[model samples]
Target: MGDIRRRWTVTARARSDRGPNGLSLLPWLLMGMGALSHLIQGDAPNPVIGGLGLFTFNTLYIAIVVRAFSPCHRETPLTWGLLTALAALTFALAIGYGREWLLLFPLLGLAVGAVVRRRKRLGRITVPLVLAVGVVTFWRDGWNSFGVVYGTFISVMVTAAILALDETVRQLRATREELARTAVEKERLRFSRDLHDLLGHTLSVVVVKSEAARRLAPHDIDAALAQVADIESVGRQALTEIREAVTGYREGSLATELDRARDALSSGGIEPVVRQSGPPLEPRTEALLSWVVRESATNTLRHSGATRCEIKVGGTPERVRLTVTDNGRGGDAATAGSGLKGLRERVAAAGGTLDSGPAPRGGFRVTAELPVETQASQEWETTG
Candidate 1:
């Protein structure tokens, strides 16, 4: 869970710091030319003054593309919004007081959109604000020109594209997060099952030894001490096996996993029905299937309260099938939480299919089929 939260935070910080790309450059160039003509052409102070102010405004807006992207705080949303508002206000004054100011109104919306990235209501209002104010001011008066309409259409298209891009980014981020969650859950499941397998065998051994010692203590002190000694040895051995199991799983080798599973289920009172056919498998595939056996048997003992676990490992020229089924408390995989989720990721990552559910005969069943692109068939083999 902590990992999930951290991932999201990292994504947000990165996204918030991103700048508008080169896609916005064309409009800036067009606007820059208009500003240059108005500033440089006129002799009168009025036209010159108006042009210089719009030019300054246009320059500030352009500078944001670089400044906001910088590591500095200039690119912050607040900075962009405030500065853009100032630019729009200056632009409005340059165009004169009436509907011409409305033509520039849509630009002011950058302030609202930047601060509220996902607000649909704000966008709904903003588009209409742009169209309404723009058409009335741009196409309304005797001063209206075709240039204004063309510019308006272009701005609208640009805005729509920007919105679409933003939405796409958000969706991708969401998908990545969901996958991460699935991975963590599967890991937890694997750990829990392994832990159960390890401890169950040791505990049962301890109980049996203790009972034997109780029966013999009145007659022989040495025999009782031997039983106590066995308990300590079993505990230390379980701990060692646990550490080894954790390290071994990472390697994901099938042969090693089979050996490990044989050792684990035997201790936990699980009778494994192992079957193997044909030649040796890819080292990686063997490891993954082995873990599947170890984890399934462990879960069978701890959760299902079952006495026996049947593990079948077989493969044809095309694919390998590993099935572990127990007659125990079988239920939905949804109740599995993080553990099953992690297992699913492991299987999926290896291009395998996992079919886990309650068996028809009053038990839980787990069947995983992993493709063997090579030419090998592991023949029937069993261990109890």
Candidate 2:
């Protein structure tokens, strides 16, 4: 809920930072008030012509500037055409009536900046436009009018830079949101896999031990009682593991899982052959391999009607390999299970590969090869 509120606030802030709009450009229209005042005073000749020119420039300026703020219309030929017409009107008026009419050049620059974003294009337009503004201002107002030229230059460059910055900020925000969503999905996948692996193995062990106890209960009460006691121990360990899995801190040990696998296989009446020979592994790698061991043993007990199972773990300094094979009728149930699929995802994420198929001798085989320095974590995904 807090995260949701934070996201909402960020969205609101982003909206508020949306830069200038069409309405914001309206205030620059006030710059034409000087010409309006001169016309009202009736101090100039050809009053009707001057009034028409001023009205036309203002109309074009408003239309072009407003369109410049809209992404859809900013690049259309119509917008460029309107801007061109406004530039022609501004230069004619500045040359015709010296003082206040020349102020429209900076407004023209602002419109150009808003519409053209690419630096190369903006440079081409501004350099020529600035040269024209300087020449016209010199002819009409004189050499002291350098301020007009400088103002036009600053207006164009600064407005373009600001709008470009706003665009970049918006892109960055979109990227951040996408990354956050990906993180949440990864964590969800990790939790689901952990739960499936923990429960799948634990339930398989419980089912096997229950069957063993039921068979021994009739004649060997002591043996049956021992089996029941083992069930209680398995149950308690499962409870602890479930708590750890929930908290996302559970780490599996290869040696511990191998011992449990032997017990589970023996209870299911399958001879277990376990072997390990490798340099000490990183905790992350061992945790990954332990999950493989647990899932394989569960499948062997529940799916393989085999009399024997062989589990081998061997590695060099750079790579490690694990193979679980059972002398059963291909153990199709193991290959079809979600547990292997999930393990595959975890291993692949850690830069490893997992393969499951029938062994050459006509039994099911599960093989996994990982870099010795694997970075796979315990909370990684498992399908089942």
Clash count, one per candidate: 24, 1
Q: Judge candidate 1 against the unseen true structure and give its global Cα lDDT, from 0 to 1.
A: 0.60
Task: Give the runs in model 2 whose Cα sits over 4 Å from its true position.
Answer: 1-14, 17-20, 42-89, 96-98, 119-121, 374-384
| Residue 239 lDDT, candidate 1, scale 0-100 | 80
Tell me the deviation in Å of residue 331 in model 1.
Answer: 4.0
Candidate 1 lDDT over residue span 1-384, tens digit each: 999999999999886645355245426344444445544665324765566556555555555443433335444776656565654564455355333333343343433333334446546645664555555555445446445545544454555457557657766887888899998876776676566545654565666567767877999989788878877876897787788667644444566556555644554556666666656777667766765665665566557766667777776778888888876678863224344555666779889988788888878888888888678444656565
Which lDDT tens digits does candidate 2 get at residues 255-315? 8998899999999999998888776778898899999999998888888799999999886
Local error of candidate 1 at residue 238 (angstroms): 5.7
Model 1, residue 237: C-alpha shift (Å): 6.0
Question: Per the 3 Å backbone cut-off, how many clashing residue pairs does candidate 1 have?
Answer: 24
lDDT of 2 at 249: 91
Off by over 4 Å in 1: 1-249, 252-270, 332-337, 377-380
